[model samples]
Target chain A: AQSVTQLDSQVPVFEEAPVELRCNYSSSVSVYLFWYVQYPNQGLQLLLKYLSGSTLVKGINGFEAEFNKSQTSFHLRKPSVHISDTAEYFCAVTLKGGGNKLTFGTGTQLKVEL
Target chain B: GAGVSQSPSNKVTEKGKDVELRCDPISGHTALYWYRQSLGQGLEFLIYFQGNSAPDKSGLPSDRFSAERTGGSVSTLTIQRTQQEDSAVYLCASSHNSYGVEQYFGPGTRLTVT
Candidate 1:
């Protein structure tokens, strides 16, 4: 069984400020990690993914995440945010060779305030 | 090129009634997935279908939830005897046959059971 945990339920940051959303996962086997964002009344969009190559993966909208295998963490970060960045962020994981059935975190709501 | 699309953007049904939600995957995608997103409850995997192999229903909450993919393209998720708890957004995603691919998502169908 695999599971993902997002420590923060909501993160409120001012415009132009940096932000980081924490995520951790527990899996018996190797896994692939991903970050997705959902705007109000819209479906989720892929932010970034860590398949196997480098630990630091850059994503759309100035977002990036580093895969820390030893710590079992894949935290999303952004240098600065805008009001448009206000959305729900989700961290997900899937087994390496088992199947693509992703296990997602509870989600972290990113509220960008002016 | 059209992305994954879901029909009946919103559905309101009475409790104990059965409802069906539809999903049309990308034209060449061979992997499809169904997920449920409830208020504050992030994304929960419901089922997964990959290239004609037996579907992995491990994530389905209960027997009341069932899904079928016709011709490995379009999918229908049926909920029998819907409950208020079943009210949520049902999301569909599809991806290429390769492993660890990013899955494209649809807007999702919001179901309100009263």
Candidate 2:
């Protein structure tokens, strides 16, 4: 069995400020990690994923995340955030079992103020 | 649909009413997923369909919620005796069964139960 945990429910930052959204997961086996962003009244958009190889992953909109195996963390980071970056972000995981089952974090809302 | 498409885009119903939401996945995509996002919440997995095989519905909240796929092309999710708690944005996504590929999401159906 596996589970996903989002450490923060909301994050607020001024424009151009750096921001980070924390996520963690626990699994008994190998897993795939994903980050998705949802704008107001819109659907989720893929931000980035950590399937294999690179631990430091880059995504759209100048966002990035680092997968820490030891910490069981996949935290998203942005060096400089903009007001348009305000949205709800989700973290998800998929394992080999459960027939491609995906487990999602509760969610973290990012608010970037100008 | 060139992308994952879900309808009706918005639905308003009273408690105890039954509602059916539909989804059309991307062409040739072998994997389809349904998720729901409540206000100020993250995405919750509901079910998954792959090819013509039986769906993985382990994430279904209860027996009152059910879904089906037809001709391996489209899907319909039915919620019986809808409750106010069922009001949320239902999202659908599709991707090839291949690994390392990201899922493409639909705009989603917003259901408001009065």
Candidate 3:
């Protein structure tokens, strides 16, 4: 079984400040990790993904995440956020050879304030 | 290019009634997925379809929830005897292939069971 855990339920940060949303996963086999963002009244959008490449993955909207295999973590980070960056972020994982079924975390609400 | 689209953006139904949510994937996408999002449950995988392979129903909560994809392009998720717990945003996503590719999402159908 595969599971994902998002450490922060809510993260409040001011505009132009750095932000990091923590995520951790538990899987018996190798897995692919992803971060998605969802704005109010909208569906989720892919932020970044770590398939079989470098540990650090950059995504849309100037967001990036580093895959830490030993720590079983893939945390999303942004050097500086904007007011429009306020949204809910989710960490998800899919196991290798397990098809495309994604196990998502509870989610972290990123509230970027001015 | 137009992204994934879901019909009946908002659906309000009685507790015992049935509701059908629809999803139209991108033209060349070969994989489609269904997910549910709610305040209590952040995001959950409901089901997935890939080409002509058997649909993965592992993530579906119960037998009351069922989905089908026709012509490998459009999908319909049917909820029988809906309950208050079934109230959530039903999201649909599509990808060119299921091999760790980025899935594009639709706006989602907000189902409110009263």
Candidate 4:
């Protein structure tokens, strides 16, 4: 079975500050990684994904992530965040050929303050 | 184009009652999935439907939980004899295919069992 682990339950940062949300996964086979953000009273929106090729994958809203095969991690990072970036972020994983069912992590709440 | 949509954004039902949550995936999407988000479980995949393939019920918690996708577009997650434990947000997502692709999410249906 595959699983995702998000070490940080909550991360507080000031506006325009950099932010990083750490994510680790346990999977025996190759897997696809993804980052999703869920704002207050809204559905989850895709932030970025790492499928193949480049280890550095960029996503919408100026967010990006690096897929480290050796470390089994896909950490989300943003050079600078805005107040609107405050949301709960989730890291997910799915086996390469194991269908599209996603194994999600316990989300990390990113609280951006002014 | 419109994204995935779920009905009855909020549902309040009494314990022991039954509830049905609906999900309308993006048109032409070949894969649909159901997930539950709760304080205890976080986010967990409950079921998945891909075209005419057999639906994946392996993630379902118990027999009381069931889901079906009709015409490969709309899906319904039925929870029979709901319990407080079932009080959570039921989210639906859809993807173009069952492979390594982005899955769009719906706003989710918040079910509260009193």
Per-residue lDDT for B6 in model 1? 99
- Quote the true-contact fraction of every model: 0.81, 0.67, 0.81, 0.81
Alpha-carbon deviation at A79 in model 2, angstroms: 1.0
Question: Tens-digit lDDT track for model 4 on B28-108?
Answer: 999999999999999999999999999999999999999999888899999999999999999999998857799999999
* Ten contiguous residues minimizing lDDT sum, candidate 3 chain A: A94-103
Interface C-alpha root-mean-square deviation of candidate 3: 0.8
Measured by TM-score, the strongest candidate is 4
Provide the TM-score for each candidate, comma-separated.
0.97, 0.93, 0.97, 0.98
lDDT of 3 by residue, A60-92 (tens): 999999999999999999999999999999999
Across B1-114, the per-residue lDDT of candidate 3 in tens digits comes to 899999999999999998999999999999999999888987889999999989999889999999999988899999999999999999999997757888999999999999
Q: Model 3, stretches more than 4 Å misplaced? A: none
DockQ of each: 0.84, 0.65, 0.85, 0.88
Off by over 4 Å in 1: none
lDDT of 4 by residue, A43-84 (tens): 889999999999999999999999999999999999999999
DockQ of 4: 0.88
- In model 1, what is chain B's TM-score? 0.97
Model 1 root mean square deviation, Cα atoms: 1.0
Candidate 4: residue A114 Cα off by (Å): 1.3
* Comparing 1 and 2 on DockQ, the stronger one: 1
Task: For model 1, state the Cα shift of residue A99 in Å.
Answer: 0.8
- What digit string (tens of lDDT, one per residue) describes model 2 on residues A1-114? 888999898999999999999999999998899998989888789999998998999999999999999999999999999989999998989885445656889889999898
Better of 3 and 4 by TM-score: 4
